[model samples]
Target: MNLFRHAAFEISVASPDGLPFSPAPEVAFAGRSNAGKSSAINTLAGHTRLAYVSKTPGRTQLINLFRLKNGAALVDLPGYGYAEVPAAVRRQWQGLLEHYLTRRENLVGLVLIMDARRPFTDLDRKMVAWFGTTGKPIHCLLTKADKLTNQEQIKVLRDAKAEAASLVGNITLQLFSSLKKKGIEEVEKIVGGWLNPEIRGEAS
Candidate 1:
């Protein structure tokens, strides 16, 4: 069975105080606006609209949570790096992301989404550095792999792995394509291990 297919919407938190209390583990999905973050999430959940796919960037303004069947949760953070969004709103989102990533005890790992053609932008690196401080694992998805050629995919994967090696903490990278439905199992295996450590012994 697909572990993430049973995911269902739980809540959307606009402020730190509104964050829910849960005993189950959580995995956060974060990326720049329009970087295919929502699409990747919906693909993983095996639902068309599990996470909203918007043509406009910065549409995911709140911290959204989705509950899995086993009690574990998936967190869809507000996308960053959209210039058109008001500066005040961007600052608020930044605060929310920092607070949750650093302070949430139930958070097990992070699934960082990046466009295959443009992996590891300055903002993405900042996110890695922020979450790396927690010493948790991060699995990066280079989304929109379908947009790249076969050779381009291999080159990007190679370069991304090399770049990720310089980042702090345990990080893994893979090419993903929501249009192609690729790399879903890889994400599931990594995230599932974090949510159920006993089953896999530990997160890689």
Candidate 2:
């Protein structure tokens, strides 16, 4: 089943205190602004506009949560590393991301989205290293794979996997394309396992 298909907007929290209590585990989707983070979520949920896709980066300043049919939640974190955003707003976003990733008890794992052509930027590396301290699993999705040639895709995937090996925590990498609807099942299976560990345990 497409686990994220049933995702519906729950709430948008601008501050840490505004975060709601969720009984189910949450999987956060985070990345640099313009990395196709919202597009990935919309594609995974099988919706055109579940997560707003804006032409302007840094538009998503709040943490948006979407509840799945199974009660699990998909957290859309504010995009980072936008030059146009004010320094104060960027600091606020950093604090919010740090707090949620490090302190959220119900967070199961993270789904880090990146452009396939450029897998990891300086900010992305910082995010990985910092979040790695949590010892939680991180599944890196190299989105916009369709933009690359087949050979380029293979090379990027290989290089990304190699690079992830040096990152802390349980890191997994995969190529994805929101435009082509590629890597949907692969992500569903991986993320579903995290949301519902019971099923994963049973399968194992």
Highest lDDT, which number?
1
TM-score attained by model 2: 0.95
* Stretches > 4 Å off in candidate 1: 199-204
Worst 10 residues of 1 by lDDT: 195-204
Tens-place lDDT per residue, model 1, 1-204, is: 488897999899897568788878889999999999999989999999889999999999998999998888999999999999999989989999999999998898999999999999999999999999888999999999999999999999999999999999789999999999999999888877787767535433
Query: Tens digits of per-residue lDDT for model 2 on 31-147?
Result: 999999999999999999999999999999999999999888999999999998999989989999999999998888899999998888999998998789987789999999999
lDDT, candidate 1, residue 32? 97
Cα distance off (Å), candidate 2, residue 132: 1.1
Residue 48 lDDT (model 1): 96
Every candidate's lDDT = 0.92, 0.91
TM-score of each: 0.96, 0.95
Q: Model 1 residue 172 lDDT?
A: 96
